[model samples]
Target: MREDFGASALLKIQELERKGAKLGMAQKILLAETGTVEQVLSILTGSPIRVNVTSQSEEKGVISREVVLTSDAGEPLIRARSKVYCRNLPPAVVEKIRRKRLGIGTAIFSAGLETFRKITKMGVNDGIPYRTYRIFYRGKVAFEIREEILLKGGPGGI
Candidate 1:
């Protein structure tokens, strides 16, 4: 859990707009999209991304992980923290995540799980734009993720 998840420092896009916010194109995409961050980053960077799980743990029926997505050349592009409810996930999905072998999106897709993403919040903290979303499986939220875009211009100004 992040200390600033509830901080007033990060404001929603609508609120920012009312306050005259000027966001770059890439920032808008990152803040508004309801898709997988891995795919979005790949498209923006035009490179395959490697998922690096820095830490993972399970407690009280919840699995959590801190992850980074990097370009093939090893430049970090995004930082993400996700927590999945174990009860909502299939065993295979849980195992894949526990093994730290794939991004949360990939693991779910590889397991052939049908899911939908809902953007719960979007904000910028310390000049880094981020979005918090929930992935639903069988109409229940299986994953809660907050991803921070690390690139300044989102690679090649995309």
Candidate 2:
């Protein structure tokens, strides 16, 4: 939540809120969903999604990355920032994550890892809607992700 969303994105969020748009079913599910977000977004939009890593850094065994999840048409859907704890994951899985070619969920699932999400927070703050959660593998916290829905057609269907 401390991350800057940039001026343009903040403007769009404010405008959507000003329009008094209602949250659609898809938006609601996004808020409460505990499953893979990429999968849920794909099903909701009826299109495959791709992960575009915006920036990444590693420090003290934690890998942090900022990414935008886009639809098949290349429309940005969700902006996410994740911190992966290397100590919580297997070496093989860590390698896949280091490659950064797949969504975090994709990497974990492809490796057939047993994981679950714990919602840490979800709500609109200063007109920006967001959800924050932690993914656990083998009962250890593996990743903490903060996501902001960026689709104008999402959130309130504007």
lDDT (10s digit) by residue, model 2, range 86-116: 9999998888878878899889888899898
Candidate 2: give the clashing pairs. Answer: none
C-alpha local distance difference test of each model: 0.80, 0.80
The candidate that achieves the highest TM-score relative to the unseen native structure: 1
- Per-residue CA lDDT of model 1 for 1-158, tens digit only, reads 56443243234665765655555666676777666677887887799999999999999989988999998898887899999898998988898888998998889878888899878877677777778889999999899999887766533556
Backbone clashes, candidate 2:
0
Displacement of the residue 49 alpha carbon in candidate 1, Å: 0.3
Among the numbered candidates, top lDDT falls to: 1
How does model 2 score by TM-score?
Answer: 0.81
How badly does each model clash, as a count of residue pairs?
0, 0
